[model samples]
Target: MSVGLVVVSHSAKIAEGIVELAGQMAPGVRIRAAGGTDDGGLGTSFDLVMSAVVDADDGDGVVVMCDLGSAILTAETALDFLDDELRARVRIADAPIVEGAVAAAVAAEVGGALAEVVDAAEASAAASAMTSDQNSPEEAVESTSSDRRGSDLSSTTLPPSSERPEEPIGANATLINPSGLHARPAAEFVRLASTFDARITVNGVDAKSLLRIMGMGLGIGSSVRVEATGTQAQEAVDALTTLLASGFGE
Candidate 1:
């Protein structure tokens, strides 16, 4: 089963808007928005957050994303009131609300576990920061590796390819979709990349990260190099190249 998500914000519109954006990439994942007070004012509500946690939970666990300080406080207080069993499965992601929710939703949609979903959320911020700091793909990969290694909750890192000595499987494909690698197409590419038992890179960035793929800002007619290393390298490269050649079914 897929993990679920909850978006908690001080403004109802903000929370709902985030949900709408994330939902475009993850239509099947359950994403509940807990925004504003019960009276529809501009404040967080413990009751609203609590109910959202319950509604979003689907036995796989829930990742909660908060907008501001008070929203986090309300979510934390709500978690405190939950039973020990339920509380064990809930996590308050240390991430930006919009980016975190989108990343978490895409991870959950791809059947990631609870910890992986949390990692996706937290990594969103870290990836953005690194991209802004160093615009090179090598730097992005190094930053991701360092962050994943440092995080206590990160159980998964980029698949290892050091043991294999041969050259990685590679292919080049042009973006034919009118919108290029936007949110939805990027999410689809990431989802496909995650299914393989290989380390894949598109234009040198981690292929399995939704945020990294979108951050590349590829446009229509842009040529992308897809490469992979590991046992399933050929399959991963073939699948991705085929998808890109097909215009991502647009």
Candidate 2:
């Protein structure tokens, strides 16, 4: 079985809503909501957390995301009650509730291991932070070679279009779907980009990172330029550009 996810929140609606949102991108993975008290109040329930944990896990593992510090406490307490073997397979991620759950769900849906799911959840915040540097929509969403895969953040500027020469290294396509490169399409884009043996970037952000692509907020009618380098650079760029041209089959 694939890795599972559990969302812990003080409000039942919040937990359930996050599950529904994340589930859209990862229909194959099990995502359980452990929200509010057993009586349906605005308080964490250790019993509910424990039950969700058990239900979510299917031998692969479970990654739990919490909305608040106290919800984490409830999750930790619930974890303490699990058998030693199962407890060892579970992880409590220190990440945002909504973004982390979506990132983790996509990773798990793509068959990532337990640790990869946890990393994906934790990386969402950092990815979002990197995108926050943009001061305006007029700036081109681009990542320099140094900033690839979030290794550096010192530079977010791209060379002026007049100075940069067009080559076979990249291709440009327009977003045709109504939602554009939002979570669902972004996740699919990242999934396809991960298959290439090349370092790829779409509009300057890491193409293999779901949050990074989504953070750009590219919408319908927006232009998408994909660039890559390495063994499969040409193939990678072609495939991604074609996917964008297809409107992600939306």
Candidate 3:
């Protein structure tokens, strides 16, 4: 089964509304809304969050997105009470509820693993912060690569430089779809990107990251540079270029 999502908020309407919005982008994913107190008041309820978590999990895992401090607290509390097996597969995402839920849902719908879904949710927050800071997509890509490199180095030894591709395989394509890289097309692009063993960038943002690709704000006729580095670099670049040239089948 694919990953699932639980949106927790203090207001029942807010939680349900987020679910509706995210569902539009991830029609096949299971998403549950947990909001308000058990008494139907405006507060997070442990029981409600717990039930939503249970309902969302379909054997893959569940990612929980919370609106605010108390909502997070409630979700965390519920997680603490879950069985060991279930608890091990759950995560509390530190991200903006609405954006995080949408990103997480799309990742889950695309069959992302639990960690990837959590990364998608957190990436929403990072993308927002980068936008506010007016960081260039190149800078964002560099930052992401640096962070990933650091994480990898911390866990394992890196391959020798000579074993790596010296130059990135690159190609250019123009966005032909009227709407450009919107949600659905962006999701499809990310899904395909994730299938390869290469690291790819589109106009200087992580190609496998849905939020980063969409954050490029690409529009019809916009030029896109697809670049990849790694064992499958050439194949990845070629495939992405072809997909873009086809307008993602729009």
Candidate 4:
């Protein structure tokens, strides 16, 4: 079974709606919603959160996402009561509830382990915050470069597709998915990209970031430039190009 997810929100409707939205992209994952007081008022419920954590766990692990401060406190309290063994496999992610749930769900759907699922949720929040403040991809690359000082900079730091040298293994394909790289399709693309061992970029954006891919705003007929570097570079490029050409089974 895949890693499960628990969404804790002050409003039951908000929690359930996030679950439904994330579930659309990850049908195989079990995502539970814990929201509102036991009396059906808008507030956190320790019992509901505890029950959801138990129900969502399927041996793999569980990742919890919260909406507000008190919701996190409720989740933490629930976790405190879990058996030690089960508690070891669960995590409460500090992330935006909706985006984090979606990213975590997709990662789990693709067989990510406990830590990877939590990382996906937190990473999505970080990526969102960074992208929101930048006006263009160049600014993003610049930020990445500045941040990498004193750290290992890899070949993936190549300039945008327009300025990069000819890659031995790269391909371009037109989006055939009627909706193009919308939320579901983009998530699928990111999920597939993450499976490879190469550093890949699609049209200059990190291939494994859901937020970055969606930010491209690529629609039907948009040309996709996929390039990769590393042992699995060729395989990564070929698979992504084929998926793009196949319309992502839309």
Stretches off by above 4 angstroms in model 1 are 136-165
List the global CA lDDT of all models. Answer: 0.92, 0.90, 0.87, 0.91
Q: Model 1 — which ten-residue stretch has the worst lDDT?
A: 152-161
Highest TM-score: which candidate? 1
Candidate 2 residue lDDT tens string, 1-250: 8999999999999999999999988888999999999999999999999999999998999999999999999899999999999999999998999999999999998889999999999999988877786654444445343347466435656678987755438889999999999978888888888888898998888898888888889999999989998889999988988889998888
Backbone-clash count (model 2): 2
Clashing residue pairs found in predicted model 1: none
Q: Residues 1-250, candidate 3, lDDT per residue (tens digit)?
A: 8899999999999999999988877888999999888888899998999999999999999999998898888888999999999999999998999879988988887788999999989889887666556576788898899999888876887679998657888999999998798777887788788889999999888887777777778999999999999889998998888888898767
| Segments of candidate 3 deviating more than 4 angstroms | 37-41, 135-165
> Mind sharing the TM-score for model 4?
0.85
> What TM-score does candidate 1 get on C-alpha atoms?
0.87
> What's the residue-level lDDT of 11 in candidate 4?
95
Assess the local accuracy of residue 123 in candidate 1 as a C-alpha lDDT between 0 and 100. 91
A best-first ranking of the candidates according to their TM-score comes to 1, 4, 2, 3
Q: Candidate 4's residue-wise lDDT over 98-210, tens digit each? A: 88998899889889999999999999878887667667788878878888863665645746789966455789999988889978899889889999999999988899888
Of candidates 3 and 2, the better by lDDT: 2
